[model samples]
Target: MSSVSIHPTAIVASGARLGANVRIGPYCIVGENVVLDADVELISHVVVEGHTHVGAGTRIYPFASVGHQPQDLKYKGEASRLEIGERCVIREAATLNPGTAAGGMLTKVGNECLIMASAHVAHDTIIGNNVIMANYVGIAGHCRIGDNVTFGGTVVVHQRTRIGAHAFIGAQSMVDGDVIPYGMAVGNRASLAGLNLVGLKRRQFDREAIHRLRAAYRMIFSNEGTLRERTEDAAELFKDDDLVQDVVAFITSASDRPILVPRNGQVASED
Candidate 1:
């Protein structure tokens, strides 16, 4: 391998594809089916196995277990894959599992993600770009995490849940349902607390846009009508607002889980 660096104590198995400038640190183990892109770094004691493809410039910290087989009892060693995007930082002891046949045979983490220590990404989960998961965050199988989402420490998401873009999951939350984009959720069995105003401000959304989104959110969640009716109204009202439309689209999209709402708001109905 030209320009690649493997520590003397590391074991890079035969048939592993190592791109230029890849670094396998001390005691790291890379499996035969693994493909490490250029400038990838597997820090000490990291185990990257199975059919995993780590993108360029990604850094996996010590003791991280990446591309492990699915935890599903139905998984019978299918050739599923774990694909991690570029420039991700996977911290110590984080566990990322590959997909299962039932979940499309792929688990994907998008570019520029920061997975903190002890976080777990289970089989078939799709994490979007620039996402951040704090320590002890456990995402169950088949969850869809949208771009720029942030998870506070110890957040636990149920299987098949979808968290929309820019949503914030507070510490110690147990998310069992779908969360809308730019929403803030907290508490055990999380409910929509409010908009992620801080995130919107930090992301530099204009005041008028934020104001419109806030108005749409209140209208959609108010007790005047069914969630579907409210969402339809919001869709028509915010026709020119992309941000509000995103929330409306997410609400209208087919989902197995209920859309989480504020505790005082009307319950999300299937009709």
Candidate 2:
């Protein structure tokens, strides 16, 4: 007898592969090409299909339309894939789409990220490890989100933007540009508010590293330096720390659509 406990109400196709100790709750559907690894749990009303692979120990909650078709207009019914990494918790009603031909060959969610309810990750967006996305966040096509980042509720990241590691984006924020490492960006068009201090504390960064990050933020934001001058100065100051180098690199790599700049005195609300 199979150790998988699939509820009678769930509909799993015969060709789908469920590994050891997997559980499928009521009304969930696993399609032919889906693969659920060991100890995975799918709660009610979930759908996994289309070359999708759910890694070990992951828990997918109710009504998540994961591994669905990419929302891009250019998709031509290709057999692209969706890969969710190990031990990740996908909360209620989150949607993860497959990659399109123009986007890439796959859309991946990295290990240990918590994608909250109603958040949508579009085609070919690659999410990194240990990130936390609050409710109703929407990441568009081809965005690259880095590790240990936290996004507040209803955050809208535009297409092709890159949000770096340990960044904090406030709620209802619109991210039109790339967010640098250790950044705290808020508001419409999401300007940098400061260094992500609370996030660094959660990661247990030492005082010295935090200070160095703050100094780099000062050069980038407070000094009113142009992108080129600030980057050159930051390179000289942060040659030792790779994290600081991430700040410089993100800024320099940005094209004509420069990443969001920091705003000095703008206040954010929780409405």
Backbone collisions counted per model? 0, 0
Residue-level lDDT for 35 in candidate 1:
100
Report lDDT (CA) for all predictions. 0.95, 0.87
Candidate 1 runs further than 4 Å off: 266-271
* TM-score per model over all chains: 0.97, 0.93
Q: Write the per-residue lDDT of candidate 1 for residues 49-146, one digit (tens) a residue.
A: 99999999999999999998888999999999999999999999999999999999999999999999999999999999999999999999999999
The CA lDDT at 79 in model 2 is 97
The most accurate candidate by TM-score is 1
Report the lDDT tens digits of candidate 2 across residue range 167-264. 99999999998888888888997787777888788779997977787777667664455668977888898899777888888888845345776565
| Collision pairs in model 2 | none
